[model samples]
Target: MRAPTTPLRPQPDSLWRAIAAPMSTGAPLARDIDVEVAIIGAGYSGLSAAYALQKRGVECTVLDANPIGWGASGRNGGVVSSKFRLSFPTIASTHGIDVAKRMHRLAHDGVRTVEAFVDEFKLERARFEHTGSLRCAHTERALASICAEADWVRTTLNDTSMSVQSRAEVEHETGSKGFVGGVLSADAGTILPLEYVRGIAAGLNARGVPIYEATPVIDMSREQDGRVLLTAPGGTVRAKQVIVATNAYSNLTEATASYHRELVPFRSAMIATAPLSPELDAQLMVNRRSYTETRRMMKWFRNVDGRMLFGGRDAFGKEGEPTGFDALQRAMVALFPQLKDVPVEFRWSGYVGMTFNALPHVGRSDDATTFCLGYNGAGVAMASLIGQHAAALALGEKPELALLAQDGLRPVPFHALRAPGVRLVAAWYQFLDAVGA
Candidate 1:
């Protein structure tokens, strides 16, 4: 892969770089060229594609409008738990039992892939500890639902490790005493988002994958010979195949508007407290395990660098996205009243693409281009795993997993009425959770 005569560079104001340290970048591409494949968006999906393809001896170029991990892959909750939040009956009904099971493994094992990379590369940024995750519940019915789901997965899916944690155990485990009970994931873990991205990008680049930060694929067209032509400001790239890995930022890409109509951009916000007192850390977490409470507007968090970093809530709208710190901080205190006066050191929010069905779409498009996207907000481990499968599909290999690969392209009903559309749905959920309806 030759460098272009000119290369794409990052914009003046990149988000991740604003808060985190800088990433080392290579020289820009200078001219139009072609490769085996071309990918847009440098987040998990794009980087994962580059990593997997490079390992397979495929020469590919990756472009991102900002630095690697600058998007949600760098800004998400960083919970690598692999439980598919959607119910089994729904998944099995849509994609069939066989396909659902494979996708299930793909989801859970996404975390394993991350663990393997961290182990192989020995990067400090991938500081993952597997204490397992806890899903705390507020009601007996919710707890029963959790147990029933776990039993169903273990019995039908042949995953026996899935089990239920008693209410007493959950209260002991998460240090959050507000819940009556919870579900414990014996196989889950957590990581620092930016750190994980850096480690993977660095490891892949070291192994000869051409990972380009600050390059944006402005538009893509098809060639007569069946290759894809991806146009960036610096130059163009032609490839035998292309993968649309832009999850949220894909909205900014011209082709993505149609793809994202059913996919709503939700603002997931988070706040991190000043380092907890040594005493607080010991009493606050269960083996440093990560957790997400059973709220309609759920609260999820884990330990990071001595701070209790927690995130939850759909930013009511664009305006809410910009100022979620106060609400989240107050929510944190309300849940764990002991930390009432703690100062939250950092706060940030980014959008996650969601589908009404809550299932991610991965399939071939009308233009013969392949797509692997819409993991809802659970991209940490799932993105890497799905990208591998998507790359396999791009190579024309049949995927063994049963996913919503060939679904319709219909927009979510009432998108123009989101305040009435989604906001009402959210309100209903909150009401149901509150009144036990």
Candidate 2:
């Protein structure tokens, strides 16, 4: 395969970025300044933290290495589901059942938090839809797991919003017979992710929190008096407290190296088809719910404005390059052959931060520095919530989620080998998925 002559664009071409409403990200920081709190990322978590801090009447500034929503926050498939990579049973087995309940509730709260932001800011352009989410089973084993999960959600959590669906029901709902069966959760939904995050930034700007794009924090240090100093190319910020919310892009700078070591950043590729015909839209995703198949390396898609937005954990060749569009297209065609002739208008990829624990981590790295990341592909809703948790932690308030409140940055063992390790694990999962293991 021939590599592109040019390196990847700072922010690759994406469906969301192309159609999102315009919003200014402000000029980069160009002079020394002091603030109560400083945030180092313009993505969902950092922006959310800035919003929470400003609400508390604390002065804060957000800095980013690129334009606003340039990371996974802008590149995701716009699925606003509050589900985590781990299942309820796994969480209950690790923590107690009560803890598992709290985690589940917290996940739901994440979804509500985004909705609250939309209502507060009147972000109609965000195009949020509370139409719920459907998880289809790709195999018999997966079908059993989906049914068990739906049962746990209904009986144990007392959440009547979740239900299991038969294969025929799944086909009728999704217009695709590729799935064996499925589970539906009314607590989930969909949104224009880039629009949502950018809307948050706009609201923050109006509320006096300045977000500086193209301003990367290159170095960080602690003062003798417990204040944190972040040095950027054009200026330096001395803040009483700092929240690092860079997520998978944390490794781009030595300043966030410690946080980077804790995560296994995996690339997720996506594709979007040109607007589907009314008939095609009606046939596929009739209810406009976020849809995913139950596979170790899963595929997710949804209907957005009569278009099919599809994505998966498939990437090839070099990092930051657009090399997996064909694979994603093949997957989409396999599921919906009718779409095989549809024109693909967008192809992009972004990193998702994964942790060894398979759960997001939030806590202080030091007295003046706090961090929240490792969403494992659930960043849209979870990041928005955890950003607030990181802000509360910086302000000396306890985080609402007990699991995160007790957790700190746990570095991966032998972090240098993450690339090869991730590849090996991904190949193993793909093989298992292929053979129905």
Candidate 3:
């Protein structure tokens, strides 16, 4: 196998960025304006909320620090799985069986919403695929737990679309012998994440929503007339309500500094190999299903246009290093030996917002200021749902995801030490993963 000759530079270039067409660089917020709603962050969440609000005849403006799809929405693995970071059993134990079931339904609904968006909007450029997902087990005990979880999903949740696969079956499906067993969810799938977000932006643009790229809201405050004032580099937006959909890239302004304490931004890196040969592609990941392991620091991979895209907890520190790319390449080789010498063409990383509790949070930071974020790396599907719910909340409507609203946003303990604490916790998790705990 040919190894990396030099250290990989930590560049912001991503495979998605190369493949997806550039979105139109809409003008920045050039002048002060008043709208019914102003959205911060032009990612999937912001665009989805804008679409929803447009459909409801609500005027909204979207502001972003960078171009659309420049955040996690464009840099994710694009698995689009309905599962959250925490397991169903853990959710049931913490909340209740009914709440867990509700959450599951909500996640499934979120997946369907993405499907609907792709279909209704004709997002063929997004490479939307209905291929299912495989949750593989790295250990025998984990396989048993996966089996139990599958059973619970079937009986408790009445979800007949999910099934467990034995080691032999999983091996046949994935062409990899590393996993002991797996669970398949037919509802899950994959898409070109950057294309998907850009497609949404296009729809919003068509609907006359002003999306101000490279315009960050430097400050936000309330007016005496119960309106919100958002100050940007070029101008300001005065709106009746505001939604913060910045997710992991949230900047700490006077109005949003408290939100920084509620979530931790953890960097996740990804690597993609050059397009594989037809023979190699047919031998590895022939099913074209998104796959991830059951490890605490898990690995996620999928086949995109005959190329292998793999990602995981490659870097535990704040910044990504060349060692992280080496780790991911090693992981890919371990799973599919036939690609041991495959040339890697892309390496990138992005941050994911993780909350104190493992669940995504959506609520009003204060009256006229609503926020929805903290996906724990499962933002593709849930972000769309949460974003729409956030828009609805801003419009004085009750959001459908009640659990997120009920849980509310609680700042992590010792918010100032989150960076060091996250590193220590990552180290502990890595130790546990290495020890097979």
Candidate 4:
């Protein structure tokens, strides 16, 4: 008798990141074939691994429950950064300064990689932007924290993007008058999420790496020879090494047991108004710089095509439905105080797999032949690079990047309780916002 395969937690929906129209999806994996590596989940991580593995002349098959970029990669706000998902000090305390530095560099380089990809491939879907970003403080008390953070980066990390943003700079730049000040970093920007995915997929396919959609790895069992049996609805694939890059929509595993606890797959919402007047943008943003707040329950915004895209996590309770456009418009008005009359053209929501520490978990594991998962919230670039790390580590080409080695992914203690924990945290913030505390 065969027991039922475990249910993989559902991935987030592509609300705002939805295509203006239906896009093209590729073929499926028909028959099982032996390969040097098998990667699950076709977001940035999966696609990146395909590119890297192909470059090294390795046979790799990318499997996705849906299509590439169909997950959070295509649905997320396009801002990319390696800014500690948790605070940097915490990472230094845990992974030490050297590893922490490497993490920061990995994230910062995602910007360059995307830009380079755009230039080399000439992909029209990705809108490569270097509009810089403003990490602003919503409260006076919070100002000191940013200042300390900036000082630490400069004196210790030798980083220098922590310049002060006087109230005038904030007012003049964002055009959303008000606020004490903030820091402007030139190390980030926005892009059309889907374009980024399609471009990467197309490039990988051109290089002969096969990517299959509608193929979910249903169940897996380890063979005596340490090979893995990945059973999908159609058939089973046997592979020597596997890399699991499936975040929110991934199969939870005995191998990924604790990671489920460490990561929180919660829904966040974003709505873009019909392109506002071009003047509205010159007034709203200096150079399309990404803007996020210092509050615990923060809102982030970016400018695109004369439209303002605002994202926030406090949309509603469970089930993750997009609040009607009217509600979102009202929230935007409250934030800008000037957009009360503006109209929104698109609204969408999706789930992001957030690690408790908010940083990414990389490395190979002993539980699986070779596997790595959990990106917390920062996946744009880090996740992309992980494919390179995972495949490389799996092929014995880069032993340092193995998940079973130093700096491997750690599972959270009780992921089954994550929704409850997230609810408790969300409840407190919801209360704080209610009282203006």
Better of 2 and 3 by TM-score: 2
Q: Estimate each model's TM-score.
A: 0.90, 0.96, 0.94, 0.87
At residue 6, give the lDDT of candidate 3.
21
- Give the candidate order by descending TM-score: 2, 3, 1, 4
lDDT against the true structure, per candidate, is 0.74, 0.87, 0.83, 0.69
Tens digits of per-residue lDDT for model 3, 1-437: 22212221222688898887755566667788999999998888988899889989999999887778778898899988887777788799888998898889888888988988898778899887779999999999898888898898888888888898999988887888999989998888898898899898887787788898777777898889989999877788999999998887775345566666678888788999999998878877778889988888888898888899999864655544565778878888988887888899999888888887788899987778888889999999999888998999989898678468834457888888877887898889888878888
In the range 207-316, model 4's lDDT, one tens digit per residue, is: 78888777777676787888887877665678888887777766333433433444677767778877777667668876677888776767788877778888877665
Backbone Cα, N, C clashes tallied per candidate: 9, 0, 0, 13
| Candidate that scores best on lDDT | 2
Ranking by lDDT: 2, 3, 1, 4
Report the lDDT tens digits of candidate 2 across residue range 67-161. 88888898888888777888877788889899889988889989989999999998899899999999999998988988888888778888888
- In the range 99-201, model 1's lDDT, one tens digit per residue, is 7787777777888878877887775655677778888887888888888878878888987756788877877776777888877777788876787887888
What would the TM-score be for candidate 4 when compared with the true structure?
0.87
Worst 10 residues of 2 by lDDT: 1-10
